[model samples]
Target chain A: MVKRGAASCLLALALPAGAAEFNAALMVAPEVDTPNTASPYYVGPPLVPDRASRQDLELRLREGGFNVQETLRWQTIRDRTPEQHGIANQFYYDGELGDGLGWTAGKKLMSWGVGFGFKPLDVVQRENRRLVNRPALVGAPVLAVERFTADEAWTVAWTHPGRGEGSDDFRDASLALRWYRLSAGGDDLHAVARLSHRRGLEAGVGATRVIGEEWSIYGAALYERRTRRLMNMLVGNGGTLAAADPMSEQVGGGGTKAVAGAQWTGASGWSTLAEAWYDADAYSRAQWQRLDALTASQHALAGIAPAAAIAGNVAWSSQAYLTPNLLRENLLLRLGYDDRDGFRPYAELLATPRDGGRVWTIGAAFEGNRQRLALGLRQAGGADGSAYARAPIRRAAWAEWRLALF
Target chain B: MSRRLAALALAVALPASAAENVAALLKQADAFRLPAESVRVETQVELYKNGALDKERLYTVYVKPGRRSLVLMKSPSEIGQKVLMLADQFWLLMPESQRPLRITASQKLLGEASTGDIASMTWSEDYDGVVEDEVDCPVPPPNLPEATAPPKPRRCLHLDLAQARSGVTYARIELYLEKSIKLPIKADLYVGSGKRAKEAWYVPKPIEGQQRIMAMLLLDDIQPNRRTVVHYRSIVPKAAPDEFFNPAALVRNSLSGW
Candidate 1:
């Protein structure tokens, strides 16, 4: 049904207007990387592919105050492969309604916040899995209305979760409003408020200010009143057996997350950005230590007792202890140099200060007449019991080539 | 016979008449340029490296003087991309991102064209000019092709310019304007070290129905074999709403109809 609708829309757009524009690209990217050599306690997959391929077809159409975009991808890793499609990368109709009012409706990609590596106020589509090497963002459905002047704007939007295989519930929809202003000194200031049926209320403020000619500082902070599912481990039979359950808890008092950063660009096209992020909901140092101890106990039990019951308990415990974004404080630094001859060299370092773990990547991209090539190396480093030390893939080297087709 | 007094007297007396003449000349020259209040222009840029075509880009520019300007990219790879300049601040709005990202003036848009170069159109406001001297056109080089030959001994006015304020791209410039039309013919940009860094030539062409003239600017890096040519495809006298200069409005304007 979705495909049929898309085809009909494309036909209508292509046929009706003489001003319609069409664009398309075909990209085939293949990569080879080293195997993972981390501890067994790591939750993610241990062995990534030594070879993988991804081919993507992207198409866009614009006509009669409407725009539509689509992407189809086929990827293979070793012997396993999957086909994925995004019907509406961005399908929106926009027009002015006189009196400084404008409206846009359809599926679109939206990004909020001012951090290079992390954004706290970007709640919509926040759960989408992102790759560090490739930073494409998925789009969401929305209907937005805005009134704007040369330096100020007020906007309201109704947002819906992106189309995919997910549980459909009230939580998948939300209403958001934003007010933005530009100061005489060229500072961009914005305030956002969102209400979700399942998550209650969330509000945030963000600002970006240019300092002098070479420096800029930006930051975003959000406070949310929502319920979180926390893990609870129960010990029974005088501490000899254990079971894990998820407990729902309401967190409303000052549960905030913030990201602040600054950037500097030199006259020679060298730029650097440094950012720091704090997630109040993330695991603290003591909590991480406790989880680490529990994992170690499970590992010891699995090694010592090979019985079926013991193995099952260890597996369950391992699953229970797996957490996402476990660290509280993180710092990111990015540096890049573009010589404008199609050669760009860049590097990024992400450090979890609380756990003393870090992930560092260095890459270079070269653009040819009709193709692009990128080479990169990534490494995770930390002491024992740290997040990076337990990372599934500790080191990797990759190369990607993209040939443009139009 | 006090040297300081004499120097001060000369400095005060020399600029009164020269300044008046320069002001008149700059005002006349401004008439040949785009309207400073509000205007829309379509621009195409072609980059050449070592005399080979490197890249091409098209853009639609909307400007409101003393307020803000927006440059929207109209090309294959970056169709709905825009850059908004509010006062001294610059922001890049990509189609995939909801919020505009603050950027530096040094960032390149296409080839040697920086975002600063495309956003700014008024030169008389940023620079103060003094009439240097009058000179005849230089003789054509021996190896120059007939088609590339210099114009025959046309009267020209040479002017030296200095920055009226800080943060401009060039610290000093030497400009030559055709005396007849007050059209800029050539400009040599100098860096802080007083060394010529780039040379630009403005070639004027008439619009079909309009009295205004549009110019094609060719910029050459002082280092040999690097050049960028910017063609003013169209410059229409249209007044954009003040609301259009805002970053949010600029982003919204990039969708659909534009």
Candidate 2:
């Protein structure tokens, strides 16, 4: 139905003389990398010892007409590791009417998914490396694109994971609305409300008010009524079987949780965040009686565990321009400490993809009229006495270069 | 020493008469402002790229006050490409399907023919002076070769052609006025863009009982970086209907026949 409607609109526009414009680009990249020797992220099983590496060819095309634009991209790597050899293609179709009503439909990554908002798309950052867990349904048209005059915009979108065979087809979608406002030369209120299909519901609200031109004070609170099934899906079934379903056993039972955090931005290019969370999953009469001092306050920053856990984290990112066109450098560093004392397997699995322990990265990008080059190094390791006590640290580095053709 | 002082005073006083006369003439010319009502002109635009002729288009220009003017293509047997120049904006009505697309001021006007800025007709406001022909003289050198006979004596005057200066007329221009008639017979225009200067001849003829200059040409030999020659094949003043200059009128007349 949508395709037919779009076709008729194009026909109407073509009744008169039509103008066509085209733009195209081609790219070739060759890379070589070592094999992974540590335990894979999914399970504590032996990792794939060695994998072959190779390069690929990519092409992009854009066709613009009176009021429509169509873009298509193709990428294929013939000789890659067993896990990496897959064709990655994306098609984007967008049209803008004279009245400002525009539509976009294609196979692009949906950036509004759970735990996906703050992170770049997997293809862009190559976070997971493996391509089996990619989102389905390609891309769908859901809303109209328009310019906003307000200081901030809160966008919420929903998705469904489709149906399954044994399990009730994972029916889930997440709606998150975040407003990042700018005031007094600094960031202001940045509130996020996320409601997912699996998790009963959750709300996180944050507010930041500028105290000076270069400094701001901010606070955020999170409340959640996590569904029991959702926890089971994450922790997997715990058993002695060598190959049992990893998502069957859930530790934290269904319960209510309240977390509060405070962070200061513009702290000399460094931000310090402190948060405390309490879960009433293992409820006891005495736990409610000692709510005031035990469930909240500055003790969270002193490395004291709330009923669940409290953590203090510091993160910093800075960029330096070496020259106008010859060189540029970027650095990212994060360090955090959590108070608790058990090797929580579930936490090790979910927390890192979320809190993502300690990470440091250094990258440089260089470009000229003829050639371009970029190199990045990353090291992510966490020492969680409370979880994954023996998890090995992981590190990786990559570099890419391209030549321009006119 | 007193004799030298008297000579200096006479030299300084010589320009006083010319300045006063030029200022008075400007006052009189104010009433002769190009009628802001409407104009129908036959024009040709020659496009040049890298100092070579690329393409040329003959057009019929219909202009109106405070509204859009339409320039319809008439040459190369191409589709009727219409360009509309409104008061505050400009647009192109593509004849392919009569789509009205807003054009940027920096785009080439007609297939690289001229810069869009020159088509907006705002160039005339950049100059400020008025000089009249106070004497009859032959056409200047370097324009008409010495081997060619001087057509007739014309009244010529030295005018300040500086741009935007208090008494300047054109950025760079020189006028050779007809001795008896005050109309300009020839003009030399030195464009600021890095190109050779251009000279145009305005040969007048009586048409429909009104005196009009119908012949015009741009000489590109001076500046090899740009080249173009335009000839007015036909012109009909006040021939365009009143509705042709409207923005909506252009859209309405676009897909439909004239």
Question: Best by TM-score, which number?
Answer: 1
Task: Write down the worst ten-residue block by lDDT for model 1 chain A.
Answer: A232-241
lDDT (tens digit, per residue) of candidate 2 on A1-406: 3354344334433544333322222233333223223412211112222222233322222234122222222222334323222222334444443222233343323331111112111111112211211121223222223211223333333333232111221234344344333333423344445455444455555544333222223344444546222111211222111122222313242444333333332211223334333333322323212221221232333444332122111000000001111001111222222111110110111122222334344444454333445555444444432112212224435544544332
Give the lowest summed-lDDT range of ten residues in model 2 chain A: A313-322
Report the C-alpha lDDT of model 1 over A1-406, residue by residue, as the tens digit: 3574467446645555557777666666666655444544343322234667777666767776577777666677775656564455667777768768988887666566566777776766563221534534556788888898778998888887443322322236888788889877768888887777655688999998877667888999988776342332522222323543322232434467788999987666688989988777666677556655654665566656654444344345444223335576888899998776678899998888878888888999887654678888888777667766665557767766665454
User: For all the predictions, what are the DockQ values?
Assistant: 0.47, 0.02
* Real contacts retained, model 1: 0.52
Minimum summed lDDT over a 10-residue window in model 2 chain B is located at B26-35
Residue-level lDDT of model 2, residues B139-224, one tens digit each, is: 43353321232565544443434355321112455544443333445557654442325655444556556555444444443434
Give the per-residue Cα lDDT of candidate 2 at A57.
27
Error of model 1, residue A340, in angstroms:
2.7
**Number of backbone-clashing residue pairs for each candidate, in the order shown:** 0, 15
Clashing pairs in 1: none
